[model samples]
Target: MILQLIQVSKSFGDHQVLDDIDFELKEPQIIGLVAPNGYGKTTLFNIISNLEKPDHGEIMIFSEKNTNEKIFEHLAYLQDNRVLYDNLTAREHLAFVAACHNVEQQEIIEICDRLGMSHYLDKRVKKYSLGMKQHLLLAIALISQPQLLLLDEPLNGLDPSSVKLFREIMTELFNKGVSIIISSHNLYEIEKLTSNILFLHDQKLIRNTEIDVPVDYFYFLSDIRKIETELTKNGFFWQSKNSVEFLFTLNECQKEKLEEICQSNDVLIYDCIQKISKTEAAYFSLFT
Candidate 1:
């Protein structure tokens, strides 16, 4: 098994962040840790990385109990850019991590090149942009060649091209048998990366094997009541944004049926926008 948590709970003062939670990962696969801000996603990652001790629970990684610092050599946690030193160049930062992991200089250079960081590697991190900093952090995490990787909001501030590159690297790592738990608010990108999700809701962990596949359509309609009635009669799941706006999930056949219903009833759909992806649909269903 890659990871296991038993009856883990955490709180600060009167605010209970994480309730008793149990989770397990049996194999190498990307799992998205999803939750609202300040809901213990980072806290869970911290506990797993041994940066913070759990209030009550046992955590196991790679079939052994989490205790020895040496066990973490096979694990990597990519935290926020605050961990980076502004005075040091990207090369200096990477060199520090490489030295700790006993990584060779040639390998460090190759990793920097692979991440497209060789161009500005020698520049001090104080001059780096948010995207550049994210790339540097990822390179630092990858330098250790960890079997298990924990990424906390790694996609933040990345451009489209950079995001694509990150996805490609994650795929490459996953194929190499590396287990990853990445926390990101970008539901669309999360869906693209993995179907498995570990959602934190109500201070507990909810595991989902697959994200919902249905597509959601947001419709601005002229006759809200009529459309609502039709939607209910047609067994379509929907939510009202307002009196005139409604969101519905429909398959191709159901979409055609909806169109026919609107045509027959003269219920004008002023504007229809397809907006939600699988992960987004799941997120809304869970949180909203």
Candidate 2:
């Protein structure tokens, strides 16, 4: 394990936030930290990064045990707010990070270019868009060359185009053997990028399970009564194609239900077989 937490806990004055939370990170994989809002995802990241220490339990890293806290040695954390020096230009921000880790300026520029933020290199961070700000924060994390990367809502405020670009960049980094733990409200993006899940619920870890499916599952919806009526006649079960559509297989006798209903109701079938979006599945699964 690249990172491990043995019975971690934290609190804000009297209220309990994270209680008995035990989690770990294995190298060469991406881990999605998911839960509803206020479940302590950000707090966990803060503890691991040493910005906030846990009230209880031990946090252990594999390679550098018993090391000093001044240098995290193998952990890099990115806060949700894109916490950068607001007055500093992007280039200055990049240069400061590179100097901290002794990474060459040339390499830093290459990373900026890869993230599509090269043009904003000379502009102050306060002037950057939310997406551009995220890009810059991610670049700083990359400079450390960490064994464990902790990201809190890294995709929080990105546009579709930037989200796409961010996914690709993170994928490349994961391929290069960086153990990543990212917290996001965007489960669609999370679904595409992760194999294992660390589900946090009610301020503690409720489940930690590896995904069994191919990350591609069918999502659809038909009227429950209508689908049931059709399925009952045709002898099929409800099969959702995606968010907007559903498909049900029926026996020959039941085949007429869908057709009859559609004709009688005059409701056009918008879709029957669409891709199941990650958010839809995650939302459904959270309840189950």
Candidate 3:
């Protein structure tokens, strides 16, 4: 196993963050850590990285208790850009991480090139834009060639092209047997990356797999009661958003039945939108 957590719990005085969280990662696959802001996603990452201790639990990395610093050699964490030094250039920062990992200078250059940082690698971090800084942070994370990578909001401030590049690199690393856990608010991108999801809700962890199920449809209708009655009578799963809005999960035949009901009853659907992927559907079902 790559990582295991047993009865992990944490709190800040009266506010409990995580409660009895148990998880195990046994293979090299990309998993998305999902939760709203201030929900202890970062706290869990910190505990796994050994930056913070769980109030009540045991953590093991690489089949060993996370007590020795040498075990960290196979792990890398890509946190925020605050770890960067404004006075130094990107090359300098990469060199520091390379030296720590015994990586060669040539490999640093190759990584910079791969991440499109060779253009401004010599420029000071103080003058870098948010996207540029994000690229630099990614470079620092890749410098060590770790077996396990923990990325907290790595997609922040990245443009579309940069995001594409980041996804490509992550896929390459996963193909090489590197386990990755990434947290992002972009549910669409998360769906594209992986189907294995770890959700933090109600101070506990919920694991979901094979999330690419049927699409969910959200409809704003003129007659909510009629639609609700029809859906319930037909044995379709649905949730009422409000007086006018309703969300439904329907199969092909169920969808045709819904269309027939609307047409027969003259229920005008003012607006209709589909939750393109199950990831967004799951997010809304869990949190909203």
| Poorest lDDT segment (10 consecutive residues) of candidate 1 | 206-215
- Cα lDDT tens digits, model 3, 189-213, are 8778998888788898877553334
In model 2, pairs of residues that clash are 219-241, 219-242, 220-240, 220-241, 220-242, 221-245, 233-254, 234-250, 234-251, 234-254
Candidate 1 lDDT over 1-288, as tens digits, reads: 889999999998899888888888898999999887788999989988888988999999987878768767889999999999999999999988999989999999999888899999999999999999999999999999999999999999999999999999999999999999999766778888998888898898876544444677998888867666777888977788988888887766787888888878889979999885556666777888
Deviating ranges (above 4 Å) for candidate 1: 209-275
Error of 3 at 273 (Å): 11
Clashes of each: 0, 10, 0
Best by lDDT: 1
The sequence of per-residue lDDT tens digits that candidate 2 reaches over residues 145-179 is 88778888988778888888878878888888878
Query: Could you tell me how far off, in angstroms, the CA of residue 144 lies in candidate 2 after the best superposition?
Result: 2.1
- RMSD to native, candidate 3: 6.0
Evaluated at residue 27, the lDDT of candidate 3 is 93
